[model samples]
Target: MRDTQRTILVFGATGQQGGAVARALLRAQWAVRALVRDPAAPKSIALREAGVELVRGSFADIDVLRAAMKDAYGVFSVVPSSPSGAVTDEEEVRFGTAIADLASESGIAHLVYSSGASVGEKPTGVARFDTKARIEAHIRELPVTATIVRPVIFMEMLVRPGFGLDKGRFTFFLRPNQSMQLIAVDDIGKFVTAIFADKMRFSGETLKIASDTVTGRELETILTEAAGRPIAYARFPDEVLAANPYLRQLAASLDEGPLADHVDLNVMRELNPEILSFRSWLAGSGRKALDEALGTTGLGL
Candidate 1:
């Protein structure tokens, strides 16, 4: 059981990953405090209603961050990255490192930093990933008990507009038989909650988390079954790859094995018994998003 008196300062609580962690922590009976840029935002208000203490501030608000950490038992740190144009890669490194530094200084018992699965000891030449690598390095050097969670690509990303779900076709970085690991966003919270529950076990550990691995063909079959219609799946055409350097680079990384076959599903299931598979997610929390992506009200799958 968690200590009821213990509070966790959660960054990015209004965002996807942070919101998942915050909700899971609260459900586990851990007091959660969130830092939000706008306390009046609907998400923030919802979080407050859910019993999370809200601290109004951005990542740049050091004074606010410090105040939020005071007397907190743990910290769950995640930051916006350059790809979203929310912050530059340099700013990402600074915010991540600053949070680690503050957690250490505040004598916070545990810190969990969310990073990308693509980030590793050597830079991947990807700004977003390399920025996290720098932060992980900084956290390791700090006098703090910290866990680094590198989550693979989120299942949510596959449903985004450009993925062609609406067109009854899907294009991605993988070939038909090639596989990539994916995690439901909610599973990230489950894993984090488990980690926090056993700080001694996870301390100083870098865990790569993913709920399921599927081939591109598997994605087509799943979507077809869910949508009640065929959805073709294919890798981005060579011409498309040639035109999009970013997409091409991501594909190259996958081929190089950095983003595939790294996670241990058995271990993930051990840590989070209820961890969601792609099919399970599509049937539950991901159902609505899938419907929206398909531009349908419901397929009744």
Candidate 2:
């Protein structure tokens, strides 16, 4: 189908993944439609300025979803999980499966669902990670042509205000030499745009995507170089992990291998050569955030 005749409906447009997808889709000359909770919000307004049509509604509204899906060639689905506390795990599953069902019923040619990389051949029993696994199973059972993109831990999350950056140190999931895969958020858009542009090749496939991998020691070196200051690196203290169930689960997952990323860098480069490494990201789009993070000290990861 011609780009002019095609529209891709995107959820979470006001947030990271959806925003990236919308921006990339527009740059590629495809009509982009976003389902938003507030059309008057700054992000939504920016989307409008950039030529995205906005449909104001929530996932709970069936009529809103139907209207947004009308005449849309593809649907890029990424829903908020337990982190937002905007919904429970059951609610997350309900919304996710519902979107797939809606897309199928709407006759969408392609449906691309973004899920977490931690999901594996079996459920990890982590609420956040397992939630996507459930969603993936539901999408697979649907009659619609679908693609599942499992993204690793976001590179952006590494440089957030907390996590000891202000104290001239960094604490994360991996040991000093244990590598973890990470992806730049914008690259997610690049990948999805390619998938939408070539539906036949991507449909029915589940892809694990990561731009780069780095160990904790590597993160220390990279951050120090980027910040032009000394920044030590260490794994989360056992005491801290033991106290926080969430952090403890994540740390355990890393140790056990389920949370560890196994994406092939060479193949991902072929798919998206513009993908940024951790240092390149800190040098580029991440510069401002890193600068801000280094200037403040917040608690927790």
Candidate 3:
């Protein structure tokens, strides 16, 4: 007995996590409204065609956010961070906190903030990771029912170009024997939709989410099987880590365990029965991305 009239204001709807959330919410018969910078964009049009209401604005505009939040039952918030160089860490914190503040003021019943898995009780010394910690703290202080979802590294990221996919070899943050958790972007939507569906259960909860875990060696086997061609896998070389401060910090964080995902796969399976494993993703949603990655000459270490 869900209310079909209830609407969820979704940020980043044109992007991965938001798009998945929008689609999932729509499938569950919830009205979805998205804040987009351009209503004319093809993705925005697609969202509109998919029955999402598009509100044109940026996160910097509080008025736009307030307008979008008006009468909305819930909000799905996911803001992009650095390396995209779209916003500084400070700006990210500001935007995230502002969304929570406005949602609280607008009397929205639930606000789900999507954060990174590496974020925990303390700062990871990485700007992006620390930035989310600040926002999470601020959300807790607000007078709102908020659920924080810290999703692990995306399975989609692995198949993206520049991961050595084009060369039939893959280099990533994990060592051969070490394991890391990964989740499909689509499942992030599933998890969020479930959270919205059961506000009482997830309210005030911080859930670290991931569907599957794999080691570097396991990745090789999976990718080889998926590609029907041998695909090798290796950790990023020491020199590459030494030369790139960002990559080095990420690797160091993983080595120290904060960046390594510690998700309860069993609980996740219960919450999202349609959760995808690495092998299933490679065979399904990730197939096109993998094909494109393999065909591109990417800058890999």
Model 2 lDDT on a 0 to 1 scale: 0.89
Residues 209-292, model 1: lDDT tens digits: 999999999999998998789999989999999787667767876888468546789989999999898998999999888899
**RMSD in Å for candidate 1, one decimal?**
1.7
Candidates 1 and 3: which is better by TM-score? 1
**Candidate ranking (lDDT, best to worst):** 1, 3, 2
Q: Tell me the TM-score of model 3.
A: 0.94
- lDDT, candidate 2, residue 153? 86
Q: Tally clashing residue pairs in candidate 3.
A: 0
Return the TM-score for each candidate structure: 0.96, 0.95, 0.94
Which pairs clash (backbone N, Cα, C closer than 3 Å) in model 3?
A: none
Task: Report, for every candidate in turn, its global Cα lDDT versus the true structure.
Answer: 0.91, 0.89, 0.90
Query: Clash number for every model?
Result: 0, 0, 0
Question: Model 3 segments beyond 4 Å from truth?
Answer: 1-4, 296-301
lDDT per residue as tens, model 3, 49-167: 99999999999999999999998999999998976789988889899999999999999999999998878787667788889899999999999999999998899888877888778
Off by over 4 Å in 1: 1-4, 298-301
